[model samples]
Target: MSKLLKDYLAKSLQDKKDRGLYNEIQILDGANGPMIQIEGQELVNLSSNNYLGLATDDRLIKASQTAADQYGVGAGAVRTINGTQRIHQELEEAIAKFKGTEAAIAFQSGFNCNMGAISAVMDKNDAILSDELNHASIIDGCRLSGAKIIRIKHSDMADLRAKAKEASESGLYNKIMYITDGVFSMDGDVAKLPEIVEIAKEFDLITYVDDAHGSGVMGQGAGTVKHFGLAKEIDFQIGTLSKAIGVVGGYVAGSKDLIDWLKVAARPFLFSTSLTPSDAAAAKEAITIMTQSTELNEKLWQNAAYLKEKLAALGFNTGHSETPITPVIVGDENLTQKFTKRLYEEGVYAKSIVFPTVPLGTGRLRNMPTAAHTQAMLDQAVDAYEKVGRELGII
Candidate 1:
């Protein structure tokens, strides 16, 4: 429209292209499953966040349809308004039970859950010790909180302890909080929660864990905190229902007091419309499925292990990942893009992670292998990877 706005947009686009940071998005023609149809080509899917394949489970679909029939498609208003429906309350209760927490409160999405939860509890007078490799939402949330944020090196307990000690003894802040991703989405590394809990107790610092990528993939589906048996130690446990829960929404699980506070103080919960009845019902059913059996979880791990071993044998450097989130670290940005293209051409759909998403010079293909992927699917993906890796000389 305006000359200045047009110039800025043009320069930004040109810069991204010149730097090989701009990614052309591909549209999926059908369901996001183990095999996906993109641009009329069927490919073995390895980029979805559906770790347990519950997104297309018949049970969750039935629950969603039943709730949609019983209730309207939408919540109609914010929770404080007329949106605190029975289904919504039931979903929260199910989340609390799944997370092994005293209570829980739901949000429209995981990104805002961090945004709202952090700002609601911490203030400018408080200091938050955060992991350097945390999700962007956590970083934005800390900024929104107006808290003095001290970054700790990725999973470095020494740095965390030192920062916590300095902030605690400074006598400059009334409260200090420690926050991290239970399972980092990029590096796929698990946070050192046990050592963190010890550090939190040592400094009397508040603890928060956003397990957005770990809910259905870790701790036997309870999450990373419960996986480490530290449920009672962490003050706040946040997660997303869209990824592993196979629905759509976010939540914070903690004490009854914490849930009550979020209900009153979190701006998103107060302003944004509540989740649809179908989503709430489906999410609850997904949680129920995870709790009743570990079948999906076990299958997911098996697939992850099988794929990782295959990729390693093929000579692709998978940077330290403990979860199902596999990364093929292809150092250069252009090379990363080229590798992704090769994989896509060979019938695998894995995306490239580059500058702004991951640090510069660390561009990679972030693979997400889920429970729905059969041995044959994984084998097919591995065959594609082998062809691409040898062609690129990345092996």
Candidate 2:
């Protein structure tokens, strides 16, 4: 490397270290489940987004293996080329049927689905009203769209209304689109889509809901839009096959015309190779299971309620989470990190969310309760939390 390049990186890394902002990645030695092994320690894991515990489900694994054996591995080309297979078509149809849309299109990831879809629909002539706490992917997608973005307060319907009215009356743009997450991952709060849809109708605004975290966890495994019973009204319903689906990829479900347009206009689907056959097969199986039964979803909510109630009873402030995600709020960053470290040492693997990821003083330990976790596992985790809170004087 050039001396200047090396020197620059060194200085930046050193700065992060000095400010305790550097993140160190851990190596998972096995499959990600309720319990995981990292560096010879077995811990009760509460840090995964696998809400339904389908990642290691035997049915998904068998489906993936069957597909791999028949189709080999990679797609070998982009979706526009020879890459789009029968399985891809099946998955798209499944997603549309599941999401209650006319059609659907898949992308390489949830991130790029946002990147490609937002840019394809809204351009420099358009304005996007985005929630302030939408995911980073949405922010990047909005930036790429070249549209004038107006930030609405997080889940504040009144602010959304005021902004929508202002943007519409100003006549500064030809098209107005409102984009937000169905569930905010950090705080685990569900979006107010009913109010959003109402406002959209009044202003003729196009609505987009990125339900990445809500895909298999809400609406009997459909999503948040369906949960609110507004599937027909929302314009773009985006989701991930990775999170709750326990595979890998993203998709946008919408009208046939919109999906047709995206297939041609979205750059990622045109340029990037499609998902490997195994991943696609696994995702298809996951959706099949999700649609067929509510057992997993029911169990997930039960576990979430149990953990949330236990933590609250123990005096940890789990800020307004309406979903399975539980954040144990610890205001100080250093204290939060130390608390996580103690939890890890005591056999629970919850991680700390400090400055920048969250507002500086609102550091937290984000806990994800999956359906695979038994009551015993949860009790053990609570015990660890109790012990650590007392030791740290946090409770």
Candidate 3:
């Protein structure tokens, strides 16, 4: 390696370690479920995005296997170039129906979906009003679009209205769009969609919602947009199949014209290989299950409520989360890492999130209580938290 490159790498890695911003990725020996094995130690997992525990569902697994057997392993090429399979169309149709949209288009992943979709529509001649705490993908997509990006305060409807009005009235851009996470991932607070819709109507701003963490967990499994009856109000509805759907990929559900445009213009769909046959089939089946039953969603809410109540009773600052994501803010980055290490020692695999994922000095242990986790498992995790919190003086 070049000496300059090696020195830069060494300095950067050391800086992260010194600042306690370095995260060590753990390898799961088995499937990601309510519980996981790390380095031979079995621990209750509270760090997955699989909100419905569908990642390990028998039905999805069987669907995946069947598709693999019938369609082979991969789609073989880009969607526009002979890779669009019958299963892909079916999955998009299921997504469209689930989202109550006239049409939908599948993508390789949620990040890629954002990257392609945003840039496909907006450009330097336009402006985007984005929530400050939106996912990195949204931020990158907005940047890639070359749109003048204006950041809005997190869920502050007044701030959003002001910004939307400012941008729309400025007469500096051809198009003005507003984008936010349907459900904020880090703190679990939901977007104020009703007020946003009202403001958008007043300003005539195009709307986009990234519901990565809300799908299958909100609106009896439809999504946040559906939860508030804003399906027809919002212009763009985005969801990740990898989240509650327990599969791997993403989709954008919208009017047939929007989808038709995306099919021809989205760079990722036009260039990247299509989602594998097994993944597409499994995702479609997962959506079907979510549509058929609310049992899993109910259980997920129940477990989350129970976990949040227990954690609060134990004196941990869980913030204002409206969903199943429970974040125990530890304030200091190194201390948060130490707290999670203690939890791991006590048989809980709660991970620490810090720095770029959130603001500095707000390091936290982000716990995900899924539908698959039983009260018994939750109790066990809380027991571990209690022990660790007391030992670490966090309680």
Candidate 4:
């Protein structure tokens, strides 16, 4: 590396260490579940996004194994070449049915789906009005699209309307789209999809909702778009199988024509190999479980409510969260990191998210209470919180 690059990196590392901003990574030695083994120590885990505990489900495992035995591992070529298996088409159909859409297209990852889908639809002449606090993938997607990105204040319908009007009146673009996350991952706040749909109708703009954290958590596990009863209205409904589905891949659910267009135009879909047969089968099984029974979802909400109530009663600021994703707000970045470290030492594995992930000073220890967490496990976690809170003077 050049001296200048070396010097810059060294300075950055030093600054982070001096300010206690650098967080140490922990090795998870076992399966990631409500309880996990880290460095030979078992801990109550509150850092996973496996909302329904389907990641370790026996049915999913069987499905994956069955598919692997039949099709073997890996897709030999990209979709346009020959990688699209029968399982791929079946999975896409399953996703469409689950999301209540006419058709769907899958990608290698949620990030790639965003990157490919956005650029395939919009261009430099078009403009995009995006939620200020949308996920990084959305921001990157907007950039890749070459659209004139206009930021709207988070959850502010009025700001969105104003920007939509401005962009519409300019007449410099052929179309405009309003995009937002169905559930804000950081704050756990649900998007105002109804209001957004209304605004889109008024402005004749395409509507996009990235339901990465919303799928299998809302609308009886259908997702936030269906939660708001706007299934057919929204143009783009994006989701990730890595989270709720307990598998890996991302998908965009929309009209038949849109899916057809994306299948041909989206670079990732055209160039990258399709999802492994095992992953596709596992995801299909997950969707089946979610649709057939609400047992896991019910357990997840019960646990979420229990934890939120206890945290509130204990005097920690659990921000404006309406979902299972909870944030124990400890403002200072240094304190947040220290707090997470202490929690780990106390046999609870929750990670601290600081600046860049969230705004500076909004540093928080984000907790995700999954359905797999037993009452006994939660009790132990609560006790740990109390002990750590007192020691750190946070409560």
Candidate 5:
């Protein structure tokens, strides 16, 4: 390696450490469920995105194993080649059905789905209006498209409408696309899709929603777009198979023409290897299970409400979240990290979000309560929160 490159890497890492922005990853000894073991210490985990706790579901595991037995492991090629197996097509069909769309196309991961989908449809001649707090993947995807990017205020409908009107009237671009997260991962705020759809209709703009954190947790497991009854109105409904679906992959569900265009124009689908046989089969089974029953989704909301009530009653700012994601706000970044460490020591494993991920002064401990978590686990978590919070003078 070059000495200059090595020095630059060292300085950048040190700068991150000084700013308390460096993340120290934790290792889980087993599956990411309600409870997890890290460094031989079992803790009530609240940091994972496994909202419905489907990651370790026996049915999903069995489906994956069965697929492995039948088709081996990997898909062996990209979707345009021999990689497009029966399971892949079936999963895509399942996604379309679940999302209430005309068709769907799958990718290896949600990030790639965003990277491929946005670039596939919009280009330098286009303009994308994105939410200020949208996920990194969406931002990167927009950049990749070489479009003129306009950032709208987070959940501010007025700002969106004004921007939409201004951009449309300017007529500087061939097309304008409005994109947002169905559920903002950091604050757990649901996007105003109904209003967004209305604005899109009024301005004749293309609509896209990245429902990565919304699938299996909203709209009776359909997603946030369906939560507001705008499934058919939105042009693109993007989601992930890795989160509540409990597998690995991402997809875009939309009209038949949109999906056909994605299949041919999306570079990831055309170039990257498709999801492995087990992952695809497991994802399909998971979606089927969700469509068949809302038991898991209900439990997820129940746990979320319970935890939020407990934390807020204890005087912690739970933030303005409408979904199962609970954020315990701590203003100082260093203190937030310390609070997380203290909670871990007391047997709860919730991580702190700081700058670049969220606004600098709004550092928080984000808790993700899942369907598999029990009352006892929640009570124990509350106890740990109280103890650590009181000790740190945060509550």
Candidate 6:
């Protein structure tokens, strides 16, 4: 390596070590279900985004296997070529039906979908009014769009309206778009979509909602757009199959015109290979499950409510969450990491979020309660939390 790179790497490693921020990765020996095995010890899982427990569902697994057997492995070429398979079209149709959109298009991953879709529509001459705490993918997408990005205060409709109006009245941009996360992943707060839609209408701005974390947990599993009854109003509805859908890909649901435009213009969709037959088939099955019943969604909410209540009663600050994503606020980064380590030792696996992922001094332990977790499992996890909390003087 060059001297500069060597020095930078050495300093960065030293800095992490000095602050006790160096992370030791642990391997999950098996499936990421309600319980996971780490270092040969089984623990209650609280760090996954498998909200509906569909990641290991038998139907999804069977679908994937069947597709692999029928269609072989890869798509074999970029989508612009002849890579698009029948399963790809089937998956898009399934997603459109689930999201209540006229049509949908899939990308390699949620990150790419954001990058491809946002940049494909918005340009340097436009302005994007985005929520302050939107996901990293949205941030990257806006940056890639080369749009004048105006960040509104998190979930504050007043701020959004002010900035949007200013951007519109200035006439400096060809168009204005308001973008936000359907569910704030870190804090678990739902976006104020009703107010946002009203603001977007007033300003004549396009509305985009990235529902990566909302898709299998909200609106009886439809998503935040459906939760707020704005399915047709929102211009862009982005979702991830890797999370609740139990597969690996991302998609954008919108009007037929928008879907057609993206299919032609989005770089990732055009240049990158389409999803594997197995992944596409599995995602289609996941959508079918969501459409068929609300059982998983109900179970997930029940577990989330129970966990949040118990944590609050124990004096652990569960941040302003309206979904299954729960955070145990511990201000100091070192203490937060230590708390997570202790919890793992006590047979519960939760991850620590510190600076960079979040802002400085707002370190936390994020817990993801999934549908697979039973009441007995949750009770055991609560007991472990109590023991670890007392041991660390956190409660």
Q: For each of the candidates, give the backbone clash count.
A: 0, 0, 0, 0, 0, 0
All candidates' TM-scores? 0.99, 0.98, 0.99, 0.98, 0.99, 0.98
User: For model 3, how does the per-residue alpha-carbon lDDT over 93-137 read when each residue is reduced to its tens digit?
Assistant: 999999999999999999988999999999999999999999999
lDDT of each candidate versus the true structure: 0.94, 0.93, 0.94, 0.92, 0.94, 0.92
lDDT by residue for model 4 over 1-395, one digit each (tens)?
99999999999999987766787788889788889997689999999999999999999999999999998888788988889898889999999999999999989999988999999999999999999999999999999999999999999999999989988888888989999999999999999998999999999999999999999999888999998899999999999999988889999999999999999999989888889999999999999999899899889999999999998899999999999999999999889988998999999998999878899889899999988999899888889999999899999
Residue pairs with clashing backbones, model 4: none
The TM-score that candidate 4 achieves is 0.98
Lowest lDDT 10-residue stretch of candidate 2: 15-24
lDDT of 6 by residue, 1-395 (tens): 89999999999999986665666688999999999998799999999998889999999999999999988899998887998999999999999999999999999999999999999999999999989898898999999999999989999888888898889899899989999999999999999999888988999999999999999888999999999889989999999999999889999999999999999989889888889999999999999999999999998999999999999899898988989999999988888889988888889999888877788789899999999999888888899888888888988
lDDT of 6 at 48: 90
lDDT of 3: 0.94
lDDT of 5 by residue, 1-395 (tens): 99999999999999988878887999889989999999899999999888888899999999999999988898899888799889889999999999999999999999999999999999999999999999999999999999999999988999999999999999799999999999999999998888888899999999999999999999989999888888879999999999999888899999999999999999999998889999999999999999999999999999999999999999999989999999999988889999999999999999999999999889999999999999999999999999999999997
Q: After superposition, how far is residue 171 of candidate 4 from its true place, in Å?
A: 1.2
Query: Which is the better candidate, 3 or 4, if ranked by lDDT?
Result: 3
For candidate 1, write residues 13-113 as lDDT tens digits. Answer: 99998898999999989988889999899999999999999988999999999999999899899999899899999999999988999999999999989
- Runs of candidate 2 exceeding 4 Å displacement: none
Colliding pairs, model 3:
none
Model 2 reaches what TM-score against the true structure? 0.98
